[model samples]
Target chain A: MAVSEESQQKRRDERVREIGFVHQVLRRPEFGAAAGCVLVLLFFALFAGDSGLFSARGTVNFLEVSAQLGILAVAVCLLMIGGEFDLSLGSMIAFAGVIIAIPSTVLGWPIWTCVLLAFAAAVIVGYVNGWLVVKTGLPSFIVTLATLFVLRGITLGLTRLITGRTQIPGIKELTEGDWLAPLFAGQFGGSVLVWLADQGLIDKRPDGLPTVQGIPVSILWWLGLTAVATWILLQTRFGNWIFTVGGDANAARNVGVPVAKVKIRLFIMSACAATLFAAIQVLSVGSADTSRGLQKEFEAIIAVVIGGTLLTGGYGSAIGAMFGALIFGVVQMGIFFTGIDTDWFKAFMGAMLLAAVLFNNYVRKKASEAR
Target chain B: MAPLIELRDVSKHFGTVIALNGVSFAVRAGEVHCLLGDNGAGKSTLIKILSGVHAPTTGEIRLQDRPVQFASPRDALDHGIATVYQDLATVPLMSVARNFFAGREPVVGWGPFKRMDWPLIERVTREEMAHMGIDVRDPGQPVGTLSGGERQCLAIARAVYFGAKVLILDEPTSALGVHQAAVVLRLIVQARARGLGVIFITHNVHHAFPVADTITLLNRGRSLGTFAKDEIRRERVVEMMAGGRDLVDLEAELAALRRNGATLQ
Candidate 1:
């Protein structure tokens, strides 16, 4: 009995240690935005009183805003961890949006066909970005910057030539289609009871109006992508190679890793992700503004950096990037409740970015010192 | 037995500069062949050629008495030739197990469904490290956290586990302290005991004189001579590496400096 009790106590101690270690890692100084996100949530709950601020409807609206940004942030996190930058992502999103819309609305192609073509086009652009960067041995920043300008120019010229305007109408017919519409735009319920009510399987609601209890379908997509990215980053050999290449290309090559191939793949993935998100937005909003995705690259980069991913490369997390996006959402909604001037939001964003960067550097320095 | 690896009349040039000229060396199994040289003595150039980082402009490389041309490092690796550079060939952020099994990671399943078999990798990495007498607390810890001597030992162990018949160590002990250097020297002997042909490269005679079965001196991109362990003394090897004629000249120059100082006084 004594021996068994001692063993049980030891096992409990080990479990506690493991949990503590995980918590310490998560709260690491580099993950400033993660902590900031929690603080922001509490701040809103306390300050943004019940009615127009802290209500369930307001929370849903906040989540809806963050869902799209969260997807891009996760993609950018992967690229950053791989030790490269993509300045073309924002423009790529616009490019993809236009690709999907133009074919469906103007060319009269089926919505599914347009979606497939848009995905393919994004992958090709990514391939080109990767190939050019690898073959030329140029910095990815320069290569992606060049691509950004070229794609932007192409987007502008194509949209103007095809539609005679900078904006294009979303495929209304496809949005109304029975088979294709629900996947792109759907909602989730927070509970089983609410879910049943939302689905109209249970006629519990008095007014018969949909309760819309679950989360947005976009949030689910974002969560699923984050889970996949995390698994790839942590579990796969390719993920290991990604960290190695980003940390030091020459060193990675010396060890016989295909550095060039990894870099190229990373570029392609960033472009493909941007394009996919753009397609989702088009189906949801029913319109594509040529300028819609203009500043999204900066937003994505900010979220990635704020998430504790190194700008220089080799270390970061997708989950952290998601948290970064959540913080952005809360701030955007919270500012309105605080009666702050909407124009001041950009300045606030700039301040938050600077703070997050400083915090990340400090944490990295500490971790290295610990080593 | 025939030498496991041999380079005959190997020569390499880069535009206007000749990095190696008529460089020749051989390593038999179960022996430590030391390559001694000062800076700019074509040591690096020769290693690069043997390791398939570059092809010699004019020369023949033989493995088990058969000529072979390697297009890339992977080709060299395929032939059981591993080079452990002075930096130790490790990724700092990766776990020790990951770095140990880098390019040759074990996989499960088939096709796109294949994934790294972590349990196998971890168990094997732990066993290998333990056999090497490395007391690592966790195989999951980043290799960067280990000491310099430990890292060098891990590199040697990794090469041996990967079935390297010929291990080329480029200045393995140059960056280590006296105690750490001694640890690496012991590992070299352990490798030789395991029937590996280790080509230990270094500028320090003391480090090489103890374990080396043969010593070859390189001076100014040319081979001074190759001597069997019984035929060469440590001082002579050092003298040859310092450039015999150049050393005499340097001594004379120092004497002149002393005389001139005396006259001024």
Candidate 2:
């Protein structure tokens, strides 16, 4: 009789005690990433406190690195949320760099034209990557992995064939007065920074210059892209399509969402982001190398995963990826400032990634499990 | 009055295989037309054609006595023919409001300021679920949290709200328990009362009998003819559904086996 009483069925529709506001906040996809970001900052502050890591100059140094990676992260975040991967993103950066450098330096083309050409090439490559995945029904991983090798090979082979050297130089002088170079390579907010330094708000160098000259345009791009990507994810009709497509492509198709189109556009978005990365690097550094952007795709994906995007897709946040990339840049530089073995940086990041994923898993179960 | 939707001697073929053959079916507004079939009975094929996932190899589909062709599922939806598939009704990870308005999201403002009307969406989602007698305390909750019956009701509510003239449900109750099945059957009746023609597909006679105004049996790849609810009784429907007296023969065979076993014992 006791067993029967325990097993008795109740009406399934009883509106259970409502979950509290705090519980609801805990359900956000960005909760883990945001927490991890603050924890990373706290940890570094303790370890590297005396190394000037908190100084404006040093802060901007790490932020510049984060900004560059964040550019790729925004695009990768969207594509991942739409349920595909473009592993060639890293290779495309190197390829786009050469496309920008070779044309402007060797062929005497304008820097702006080379940048445009690089973007155009990226669109075609992205189209191919998406087409193969959509039409052949191959997993995007395998398709884009194949693309990775092809792009890198082309970058190396074409650079060697054309210039007889792996590196391209002499593009810096051409960028000095170039109309488009400042958009990608230069900095802004100099007057504001100088004013701050005059007011003793930030440190000034021995030569009467501010320790940090200005904010990099790359930082602006990163913030702008994150805001736009977040808007797309949260508000637009296409945003809803992306979520449903990733959540269940078959179900999305049944409900009349254009799953293929969403995926293909996402691929193109990531490719253009790669070109943007290359434009910034190749212009600012004043050289191009065949080996640039190696393992960057993995880095971006890791940042996205740390930011709380599902590895399997369908759920994530751009703000989360921003913090994920910030954590990456801070930790990489934090080891240098703290006098830890530089080689331990990768190991530490790997550990951080594992921890982030585990935390995300725990939070996911908490958010979705039965009351 | 002409039926809201009619399949006139429609047949479908996939290369050499015949999936449906000359299956004539009609569903009028204000009725639940139950499609009863056993396994491999071409029920899936017939509904696929009716919902515009596939075109008939022969014959025609008429809406209110006018012929129409649907090139895709979206086309069918545009023409007010909505289908709620058994497993393909919703994306589980998305919020109930998001899933309710998955492909057709309503927006406000203009240009870059245009965005999903979350307040409006949440209100509509809550109101619609309530209309279907489902209690959804939070429209922002992931749809996966809803019980199977509630999810089915959400799908039905979505189709009904989207102006579905003829609703196609593909084996909506086959995976549900008795209680859940009854709930879904109640939704079918509600849809009928709203003057929308409901195509209720199932193999279970018990589930079909209560809501069905017209019973249409499918066997192999053809229809056994349609019958009004008063034209047939429960026992006769069951016998006909069991491949025409095969159940009687099966019962006799079981009895013979029992007698032989007793003798041996």
Candidate 3:
């Protein structure tokens, strides 16, 4: 009884010296990115609030932009947490767009079939990327970079050879009244917009149409994907596998985790995300261009990094990347609404990235020092 | 009786640097087999072979007298051989419960809705830590915050809990304190009582002697011999180990260095 009592006292002392509540909250990877989101929002609300940046029309514009990037960022965030990079994401977008367009606009196939084909192509590309990296034992960055260039070249060469032009147009007409078109390319909640306009809560154009017809489906996709990703990372056994594979793969393997399969599945997820991005773009824009989705891969990666995912991997959060995407969309459109030269946007991204890294480092150090 | 797991005349040569040469041993159910050796006495190589990290260049591994070969670590684990390594034990960044069930997590629901049973996981982790006499404040706490001894205990407990038959621990108590080492020794006894064939690899005879049913000595990639604890006195096993001469040589060299130094003068 005396020994147990003494040990109990020691445990109590150890608990007191352990991490406090504040330190635990601060140590979470999302804390810095969520804070950054708040600060950016505050800046925009003060500067661009009067310039219609918060208006229904302007809000939809930026949210649509965020939603698109959020989809890819969510996938990239998972891959990064699994300790890999897919540089071919941007090229896959362009290539999948061409794949969707060539069938629907040229061969006159059904829009649904074209969508399926694009998904199929993405699966093959993803599997090969995963296979090469796993089999060759090369860094994923190098293997996917090779894929990036090859996919871009193939997209360009194939489009010009068959269509005699770099662009495929008139896809909008073909998607009209198609049952499957609305899932990837349309607005939701039109009745909600109508009701809001009727209640005088939202603006309506002179023609009696709401300035923003409805919320874009992409935002729905973004939130759904984020929720799902968060669920996978937190609630599922596969989520645990991903963390283990990224944290210490040799240890994970020793404990019987299938390291190769986890990595391959994550790579496949990234490719599918790019394909979804392409489908949304192709159906909405009414055309597929070789230049579509250029540099989107880097943008998604920046959003993920700003979200506080370590480049080295094994630790991060999906919600943080969501806030990271939100911050990005707000700032990009905020500069436009505030009438700053748009060229300065890229410079701001660089500064924000550096600031986020410094802040994350500071918070991590402080959290550790507190204990 | 046939052994639960047995290695017969195993030889492993790595580019002419022979790590193990014609070594043989057997671990039976309900026994604690202590492997005593120096740092480079083929103990690691032998463990590696048994754990399926490396296949023997020439040998036969028989499980219940049935010859078997493991192609990978997973293959070894599938055959109910769980190995807890010295360095790569538990993932520090992971939660204690998650680390406890890294590959084999208990799930609830069906198909896509299947997920980790959070309440059960936490409860099991806390209960298991308590069983091993380690007070875990929270099952959700990252393993990194634990002291070195606690982390070692967590790894050993994980191995003991999940190990179906054979439990191979490589220097499990190397980083432990006196109290923690005692806790691990007691846990080993419990595992053996539950019909586990434990291969406890350590250079410390003091740690090995109390619980070991059989003691095997190795030196320079060769097995000196295996003896029942009755046939081997605690001090005699130390003399037969590779470290006996090496420690004496190290002390003599240190004394000569002291003689050459100005402080000695």
Candidate 4:
């Protein structure tokens, strides 16, 4: 009995030590990006010191721009974590935008019908990308790079053949009639803040004054997508299969995982996401040029890598990618407010990319070594 | 009383290279049948056939005295055959519970709206691990953090949980330390107690002598012989693996060389 009691005490002591160890590891000085984000925010606040930049109106505009990029970044992050890349995403957006616009503007189809057709096309393109990659056993970089060029060329050729110009017009007619236009781009009370206020679902406050509590409809879309991605990544048997396949295909196959199927599904998901973002852009702007959405794939990839996703495969978070997009949005608008040259924006982006990669490498190394 | 699994004159060839030549073996319920072989002894080929990785060039595999053909590992699993490979087929970054429940996770809700039952998975995983005497603090912890022996044990427990009647362990102890090896051997005995037919493959004869009821030695794509542990001693088994009386000739040649060297020195 005495021996058992002593052993019990020892177990208790070990548990306490383990808790302490976990706490220390969790609280270590490795949150460099988080610190960097705070530092950037401080830099903007202290140096800019402009009332216009700090106003609620500025914040709303910032969120509006970030939402679109955030959606794209999250999708790219999922694909990157699954151990693949899609350089054709930007071209896909342009393709989808033109498809939706042409049908609604030129063919005079209902706005909803055009949107659905565009979504279906996105899904099909994504499926084809996945199928080709799996069937040929080629690297996704090569497959998607080839696809990017093919899609861009097709978009250009189709636009010139139909509209006899580089850019297609008459999209304004569709937006003027459709109710979805205001939801995407029209502002309430002619200000970004009032537009945000009109999006609220509930209005309740202690004071009689009107409470500004509405969330942007785009944010609702992001929230919905985030929930779905989280469910697919964490809560399904297929999710397990995806992680295993990405971690090591041979090992996953030996254990009876359907590796090809998972990759295909991920590809389809990415294309569909890009298409959805394109549809939003079309509805908001009410028009699109042949070169619309150029280089968005690089921006999406940068956001994903910055969010701490591994380029090789098997480790990442979709939510992190959303925050990475927000960082991009803040830097872009923040630079503009500081009266910095727009051309220097690319240099700042390059520096941010380098720093994020270095930070991710260090974090990943530390995580592997821990415990 | 019927054998849980049996291979009848199985012959497999990889292109022109013959891997297994008309080898037959039986594993009875609650028995440890050790398959011993040197390098390139066609042990891996036999394992591949049993685990449904490859079909035999000529032969019939019988489970419960009925002929069976497995199209995939999932098919083999359906027939209660589970193989724990040397690398312990699992995702290192995923949680222990996730690895255990891969390809067959429990779900709640209807189609297209279904979600994994995480709480149930955690509860069942903990219960299963406890039943196997594996003390783990969190089922959420990644399997990569576990020791090699613990990983093997987790695989064994997973097979048993999935209702495997035949557990084929391929070189499970080759990469383990002495203490870790002992732990695995104890788990083998535990599996036997649970009425599993275990095909424990190893190159070491000493490790087999403790838990194996029958030992089969293979050399050069052919079985040397199968021996009941009670009938043949460890030395005899070692001798057969060393190729009958040829070991004695080699030992005498070494002794003669030593004697000549002593005189020269």
The lDDT leader among the candidates is 2
DockQ of each: 0.42, 0.54, 0.53, 0.44
Q: In terms of TM-score, how similar is model 4 to the real structure?
A: 0.87
Error of 2 at A348 (Å): 2.4
3 versus 4: better lDDT goes to? 3
Ranking 1 against 2 by TM-score, winner: 2
Write candidate 1's Cα lDDT for A38-133 as tens digits. 898888787776535655556777887777888888888888888888999989998988888888888888877777788898889999988888
Query: Candidate 4 at A123: error in angstroms?
Result: 1.5
Better structure of 2 and 3 per TM-score: 2
Residue-level lDDT tens digits of model 4 in A250-312: 767766778888888888888888887877778767677778788998999887777667677
Worst 10 residues of 2 chain B by lDDT: B236-245
Where does model 1 sit among the CAPRI classes?
acceptable
- Residue B134 lDDT, candidate 2, scale 0-100: 83
Which candidate has the highest TM-score of all?
2
Q: Which has the higher DockQ value, candidate number 2 or candidate number 3?
A: 2
Q: Assign candidate 4 its CAPRI class.
A: acceptable
Q: In model 1, which regions exceed 4 Å deviation?
A: A1-33, A49-53, A188-214, A369-371, B109-113, B259-265
In model 4, what are the clashing residue pairs, if there are any? A200-A214
- Compose the digit string of candidate 1's lDDT tens values, residues B1-265: 9999999999999998999999898999999999999999999998899899899999999999999999998889889899998883876656688788776677787765667889998898888888788756567666667778888888888889989999999999999999999999999999999999999999999999999999989999999989998898888887888878888999999999999999999
lDDT of 2 by residue, A1-371 (tens): 87665444222223233444676667788878888888889998988887988788888989998999999999999999888998999999999999999989898999999999999999998888988999999999999999999999999999999999999988889998899999999999999999999999999999988999999999999999999999999989989999899888998998889888999899999999999999999999999999999999999999998998887778888988999999888988888788888899889889878987888777656545533
DockQ of 4: 0.44
Give the clashing pairs for model 2: none
